[model samples]
Target chain A: MNKLRETLREAIVEAGVKDGMTISFHHHLRNGDYVLNMVLEEIAALGIHDLTVNASSIFDVHEPIIEHLKNKVVTGLEVNYMGGKVGRAITEGIMEKPVIFRSHGGRAGDMENGSSKVDVAFIAAPCADDMGNLSGKYGPSACGSMGYAFSDAMYADKVVAVTDHLEAYPLADVSIPEGYVDMVVCVDKIGEASRIVSGTTRITKDPVGLRIAYLAAQVVKHSGYLKDGFSFQTGAGGASLAVAKYVEEMMEKEHIQGSFCMGGITGYLVSMMKKGLFKTILDVQCFDMEAIESIRDNANHQEISATRYASPQAKSCAVDSLDVVILGATQVDLDFNVNVHTDSQGYIMGGSGGHCDTAAGSKLSIVVAPLIRARLPLIVDEVLCKSTPGETVDVIVTQRGIAVNPKRTELKELLVKAGLPVKEIKELKEIAEAITGVPQQVKPEGRVVAKVLYRDGVEIDTIKSVK
Target chain B: MKIVKNAVAGTLESSDIFIRVEPSEQLEIDIESVVKDQYYKAIYQAVDEVLKEFQVANGKFSINDRGALDCVIRARMETAVKRGGEC
Candidate 1:
């Protein structure tokens, strides 16, 4: 039986689109995604309101949701990461309800546990068959990995596959099997493939950022985690990419072969795997075009689901095997509480994508950031929003100095004895203040605008509306 | 001191504040900042201090702060106010 639908509106009606329902979308296409906006525009035109969108992440391209918010066509939002445009509006208290932010793994777990149920999941597939088998690796809009959509396809009451490329039934390869999909809709374009991997994947050239990266690599080398079979993860930030570069050099110099490098896999990590630095790349998501090509061709570059990446409820996830994870922060507190949820002025600009999960599961969670950004201290008395708890964090690396969490005293000693600049977290704060001048305490006056949830589905912090 | 002419100081760069002062019937201060939530009060306080020092009570002061420190904010406000009226 053919599952193909002629248009998105027909698929929406088939999926039973209505007001006040929790619908979901995956962000495997990232900033290039058009399905969410397209579907929402249709739903709004259908006069639907009070719909809660549980997207895997929200990007700058989804700014049309601002007008939807004003019209009360969409009222609730739940996401793992948020780009700056919608984030600024949310910070301004556009919605009466606070946005719910979950980690990548946390979102998967919640879906599996039925805590965050989806009435319908609209998946943007790169290629699919009439009978609904889908793959993200073989079409014009290919984004390489459909990892984030697996749970949505499996758990949602209705699963609609929107694709630009329609293959014949009984496809050769399938990322999502036909059994899980209910409907397939062929669209002119699913997304812009070029914009899927944005420009944030390059290595840093800023001297201060490079210095921090270098020091972070030194800490990883000296902390005894750089031995054989080490598994590592890092963000797609410029400085984090630079850390990978330095670490790759160190691994080659010492001839240490690692087990795996995981997370949003980048070309830098792909090169490391190619050079025999790591035996495999456990990529939950591909961050760049090089990574996409590598995963398409390389045997060792494997795609993993979000649950397999960092689910706390999973029997055992890849993050548990991680030796080190380098993350960036908007603001870090004296206690090492990392705030990736909001900026220095309490504006919603980011969220706990994998920050909490990796930090919680990795043997050493290292945060690297400049001491000051825009003349505002990076290290503060208290983070405006606690995205990752301090206890899970092991070290804080800045251009000026490094601070190991008091709980990681052994790691601290190891770095200090190895001639690294190891100092107290408070001291780092003082140094930052000395450079930027102690900033006045930011007072956010309105109601809470967002809730930062840990990997275990607990609310760690609430972000107040920017006054 | 009565305000003489509209004047502006500083540049719209990080760690700097651009302040402009002009004649007004009553004291008025407006501020826009990158770190607005955290430093707006402090920036307004700095401008008030500078205005009080100059004894200028009836001029409009507008500031665009790009995370400037209190000292830089004060300096820019002082300069702007000085150029606005008799030093």
Candidate 2:
């Protein structure tokens, strides 16, 4: 029987959305997503209030959520990451309850274990059939992997697939099976194509960023983990991409064939896989058009569910096998604790998407950032909000120097032996302070605005109001 | 140095400050910054030091900062004061 519906309103009504129920959405569409706002508008029109939104991530384009939050249509937020627009409002104490933050892996684990429940899940399906089979690989608003939406479809009490492209029944390529999705609705569009995926990803041209990338690449080479069949993960940032470039060169020169490259797959990694540097690409989500194209075409580029990608509850996820993962940070303390949740001014502008999960699971976790950003030093007395505990972090690479975690003494010795600039975390902080002067601490005197949960479901830190 | 005309220096970009100077009845420095919550005192002191060095007492100094360092702020304020003074 056909499960297709006429509109999202009909689907929402059929799902029985009620006040205080948790509704879910995924961020595969990134800054271009329209489903969340659309669904919320319908729910608000239906007079739903005090609902908790469990989105995989929130982007600037979801700014309409700010008005919804103000109107009490949505009083609670639980997310893996948040862009600055809603983050700024939340940091200003716009909601009575502090937003609950979880890592990508943690979000999936919580959902699977029934700790964090979702009443209804609205999947922004790029392409789907009347029978409810869906794939994010084809169609106009295609965003590559539908990794983050799997838990929502599987664990939620009701799952509605909102699609712009309605294909025939019994679709061949199904990322989300029909058994989970109860309803499917065709819409004009799921998201803006341009905003969903960047046309291309670029490497850094900045000398400071390039220097940091160089040092980080050197550390990877000497860490004794850059051997054949090693697995790796990196972000889409300029420096992180540049590090991949360097590492690719080294791997090619040394003829070291890697097993797989995982995380938010970028075009750079796709090229590396094509060049025979890696055997496969374990993509959780795609970051650019090239990556989307590769995943749609190349058999070696495989899409993986968030549970298989990093869920701690999994028998053993891909992250546990990850050899190296490079991440970015807003602040890193002398204790090596990393803060990606808030900025130097103690405002909530970011969160731990997979920062903690990767860091905790990978054999070596490297945080690369400039020593100074807009005059604020990177290293500090303590991070304002500890997003990822320093123990999981193995290295901190800055343009000036690289600090190997004291717990990683053998790795430090290896890096030093390679003639890389390895210094104590304290020394690196001192070097930064000497150049930028000691910045005054931004006091967190206001009430709590957000709670950061580690990958293991523990409350790691609490973000305070900006006032 | 004597207050002559309205002048501006620096940029609004991150790691830079935009400074505007105009003749006023008294020394008035207005500071707006992205980092004002944490670095307002340092920014104010740097601007004051620049004004003292130029020895210009009566000007409306408007500083809009995007987290510029002390040295960059001082340099921008100095250039702004000089531009507002006699050639």
Candidate 3:
């Protein structure tokens, strides 16, 4: 009988700790994540620096990571970080180097292509059996889906499952299989599921949000694309979900039978699927209890891998099949280039995870947002950084009006001629500048903090978060 | 004037819901006034019954719906009436 060491420190030494090695972590825990900190503190204690960290996503809880960067214990950074403490700090020019940001699909594609090779992947499995079979479901800290970790387990050179609860043998229905794992370490707690799933994906309460939703739906309805056999996807935000709601009403009124609704499945979508509004739901991950329950019960709620969701080379990616993809933007520029990456000051708050992919693949990409938020203009002369290229953004819809990309002159003409509430993107930009007086410039020290890579595996622009 | 009556006390009152009593004479309703959500009609139904319970009559009442689905809407409106007041 073979025996394996159980301590994280022991596991680290046994896994072959070196000066320079690639380490990966998953960000399913969101803002309240703690796995990254626990593991990094130990890694830093070992004086092992100059390492590449592949996180599925980074959250505000990862603020301690800044210490790692400052101490030279960590060098390269990678993950999808939304606007929060860590993201803002990094964007504020805290990190000395630019980060490598990838969309959810992009990260998965990287693993498949051997580009993002991980030396060791530390998975914080919420629940695990003695032999290393694990799951994020059925545990106190269930985050619903193991979609993000699925890639790390497949591609990483060594897989370690750090978990709080270790079940007895006969671990059936595995979330992370025993085959891919090399060792297991037990901890007091993996995370709080309440916190992981705590962030409410509710629609906006603001009247302006309702207005934008109404206008965005009107744009779709007027574009004459509100027809049968169409397909769509939207993020799980107030504006995005509202777009879906408004669009749903239009489709029902027009008797339009959509082919499918894809990506991050939510209860709102499950209800629509239940209503037979769409024929299928190609779900990559579930966002709420209803979505998880729907996956458990409904045959149509198909579980999809990242590669199948948006690989440029896939035989048929779900994103490619999208007739329209409603995306959220932090800000947009006159060139129509949109930035979901950095903040107004060009900090790496988030990246293109599937944003660019979907925008590029979808037939019509609409960026639905308010013209001004907290009195800050959302439309600027030049985007702080380019995450989703303007070429793919067909329509920019706000509560005030809608602007079609000039490159998409056909769409511009169609929307304009159809009497859709239309305006030039410049008009929105000017209004914002007029209100905010061209917005004070964000000065970021000229050292790349993250690389914004295009789909062809080429570097487009390097982001320097403001210092 | 229509009046809404019979409502659940404290528990349901504090939530994002309401009840109403319409005496009659009201067109369908304004979509703009309705809050965007998965089930906005819930707010509408709740308000309708509260008015019926009170036997209040002859005025228009508007509802600002959030996410209260049909069932939730009906529940909230009727519940809001115990501490009755006019909208």
Cα-based lDDT at residue A186, candidate 3: 85
Give the Cα error of residue A16 in candidate 2, in Å: 0.9
Candidate 1 Cα deviation (angstroms), residue A163: 0.7
Interface RMSD of candidate 3, in Å, is: 15.9
Per-residue C-alpha lDDT of model 3 across residues A1-467, encoded as one tens digit per residue: 22245678888887886777889998766655678898899999888988888897887778898889888787778885554667766666666666787777778777888888998999887778877887765566666567778788888898888887777864765767788888888877777666666455787777888888888777777666678888888888887888888888877787888888987777888888888889888876667767766765677776666677886645667888888888889888787788888755565667776788889988888888988653357887677787877888889998878988988877788787877778888887776556434444454666676787765466766777454
Question: What tens-digit string does per-residue lDDT give for candidate 1 at A1-467?
Answer: 76888989999998998889988999989999999999999999889899999999999999999999889888999999999999999999999889999999999999888888999999999989898998888788888888989989999999999999998877787888999999999999989888987654778788999999999999999999999998999878889999999998898989998999999988889999999999999988888888888888888999889999988888998889899999999888888889998887788898999999999999999999988877788888888899999999999999999999998878888999999989898888888777666677885778998987888888888999977
Give model 3's docking category: incorrect
TM-score of 2: 0.98
TM-score of every model versus the real structure: 0.91, 0.98, 0.78
Residue A331 lDDT (model 1): 89
- Global CA lDDT computed for model 1: 0.89
lDDT score, candidate 2: 0.93
Computed on C-alphas against the true complex, the DockQ of each candidate is 0.45, 0.76, 0.01
Q: On residues A42-85, what C-alpha lDDT tens digit does candidate 2 reach at each position?
A: 99999989999999999999999999999999999999999988
Candidate 3 chain A has its poorest 10 consecutive residues by lDDT at A434-443
- Cα error, residue A374 of model 1, in Å, equals 1.6
